[model samples]
Target: MTENKDKQPAAEEKAKERNWISASLWADKEDIRKGAERYGEVKWYKSARFWPSMLVLILTWIGAAVTGSYSEAVGVSVILCPLCYLNVKGYRWSLLLFAALYTFDRVSVLYMRAESGQASGSGLWWLLIWWLVIVGATLTAFRIENYRHKHNLAGRGHYVKDTLIALAFPVVLIASFMAYNIFMYKSSLTDEQRKALAFSYGFISRNTDGVINYCLRSGVELQKFPEQFRQTYADEITKVNDWLEKDEIFKSGMEASLQENKEMLYEVFENGRKDLIRLTIAEETGEKPENLVWKTEYDRMISPVEYCKLMDESFEIMNSTGFFDSFVETVKTLQ
Candidate 1:
């Protein structure tokens, strides 16, 4: 009985020792083991995780290359490599790394959008998706580590070392590629090109406003003209209407005009004045009749006199031949 009692104490001591691992040290050890396993799996490219991840990476590269977006391909490749490594090894730190990298990548996209003066709505959507994936992967890693701890898995130290090595390699590759791009493919736009682009945007804005105003006034005037006038002017009015529908400049102009007027002219005249003036002058009469002439004489015939004056002012503002020449010169300077 004494011998059995002594043996029981020794067995209890061994059990206590086994359960008494320092939490911090054990966590570090588990991390290292997970990393090493991930590294080995990635390096061999033989794990189940490898095939799908590699397939995605290859497909992304091919798609980006086809679209002539090499930068996108490189970025995707960088992201995919680490993702694959993490999935195979199931490291907690891999999830953290993914989250950090994803955040950094999204910030870069935001910066690019700001530089171009564009909305980042789509970018935000993409970032949200990435965040979800990172979070899901992290939770998966935590579950996996818990399983490993329960199982008392061996060679955790080797696994951790492997994961770190795997992570280091791809990181270096991505950094080198970025450095090369920064050093080699710098784009420096000339002053003239910048000015020309500014002028082009301004010209586009002004013309759009003019087009909208002309369409609205013409539609109103046409509606006021006789039915014969509407038929006679059908083709010309149709051409103008088509231009209003298809021309981006005209559409922009109409939008601008509607905004300026605080009136919904765009909604009213969306279909344009197809039912308006069809007036035709009788060639035999040779009389300077008061029928609504669709010719340049209609400009002189414009009433309220103020509208005519405004039309004239618009024409003068839009008719800067020197400005056009300067715009062309600016484009040349860019080249």
Candidate 2:
């Protein structure tokens, strides 16, 4: 019985040794003291006081000039000390200063919005909420720092959680900004309004899709159309121009149709420009005009005026065949 008791004591000692080693490993893994070394080194900058502060002030001025938000830049600068308080001395004073700066910024934004006759909506509410979050996060970070001073809690898992909480405000602010941009894009236009705007911008064309595809396939063919073919195309275009000039109904109908398909026209124009270079190259290669490659190339090399003429003729042909409306609708639904 005595021998067994003695062996049990030795086993306990071994377990204790193992536990101590494990704890030492954890301490090494999560050493906040090593991380704080950079904070300690920042004392030299703090000692320089006026010069460093003035540099930040100058940087704020530069940011204001660049961004056209002087008040915001100044507000950010005023709050910088509190934001960096985790790595600096006089953290309490910095926190107070930051709170004051935030209050001033809120008042200024409200005043500006009022002056501009803009409603104080989600953006203003978000700014207020963000300020509250910043205050809460700053205080939490300070409390954590104070707790670490009294107890060795700095290297624990809780410390990492606290660090994440401290980062949450900035992350939320960035996310809100992104959400606002997306909302603006979606809510700025109605379906009919968007279609009308696109049409007015020059998107209407009976052969827009085929032309765009042809251009994409053989942009170089546009350049290959001999000067004679261009003249023929031009003469055909002039004939339509003369007809539109003489017929008010035809002219008005053409304008209305174009207004409806403006977006498609813009897309085609942009796409055609890209295809022009390719069309020029294809023309030099003697590709047939009716070939997809040649047609695409030809469309790309055609000027806006020429393209409009082609589209008008195509629209007239489609209308005579009773497919103009269907064709326009189909092109409208495409990119």
Candidate 3:
């Protein structure tokens, strides 16, 4: 009887040693082992809420699969599937992991919306719904974990490291994503598109003046291409020359007027600037104020002489590129 008592004690110690070794490894495996010992072979299906929580997760996954791109879906699955398994098996650290992912995702979406200055009510509602569902699923996992603890079925492990790792995941993932983009990036623009964009940028760079406002004040109808062409290349060149002549006349008029009314022009410019500042503020704040329009042509008031010089340079650039000749040739090819 004495020997039997000694052996029983030794066996119990061995069992405890085994349990400790199991628990120290990974929480999910430990939970399953303990749960199986206490709640029969079908340990995972012990809780009534388990299936429901898992159903929510599965549906969320399906939603992502349907809505997201292939790469995004795969990425989400890699991170989410393991969390789902661990969470269902009663890992509370999974909550922190899920929360980290959720925060990153929501923040990214909000930032994009802020940048674009547009977000539909329906889109926001859907995001809210997604958040609520995640919270609900999280609460479900907490309850299961609590139940495991109460039943002496929960895994014994220090989760501090796990929580810290969960927190670091977003940072790592973001860094990896940025690195991938930096290294693997390729331009999607065609050669023609690139050339067209380059030409547009050139014009934009040379546009020091508010050309629309200048044309409005000068009574100059800027020459339109092809549509305004008079059935011959020579006629088109004449039209361009006429437009340039009108621009010169407008510049001469501005210079002479500046000589006469320099101080008056300065006052007009300052007042126009104040009006523009007020207008910009009102627009940004979504407020409409009376007399928001500039009292004078604010754009024309500041550096009218410089504006004429820039316009001449812009014309020179347009002509120097053989743009007119190439456009005519392209149109002829189409014919």
- Per-model lDDT: 0.47, 0.44, 0.48
Model 3 earns a TM-score of: 0.34
**TM-score of model 1 vs. true structure:** 0.34
What TM-score would each prediction reach against the true structure? 0.34, 0.24, 0.34
Tens-digit lDDT track of model 1 for 148-194: 55666523545767667677867887788667655654353344534
For each of the candidates, give the backbone clash count: 21, 29, 0
Tell how far residue 39 is off in model 3, in angstroms. Answer: 7.8
State candidate 2's TM-score. Answer: 0.24
Q: Could you give the candidate ranking by TM-score, starting with the highest?
A: 1, 3, 2
The number of the candidate with the highest lDDT is 3
How does residue 259 of candidate 1 score in lDDT? 42
Model 1: residues >4 Å from true position, as ranges?
1-63, 75-83, 103-134, 159-168, 171-327, 333-335
Of 1 and 2, the candidate ranking higher by TM-score: 1
Q: Model 3: per-residue lDDT, tens digit, 24-93? A: 2223544444543554344454332244335444665687567432234435645775565555445766
Sort by lDDT, best first: what order? 3, 1, 2
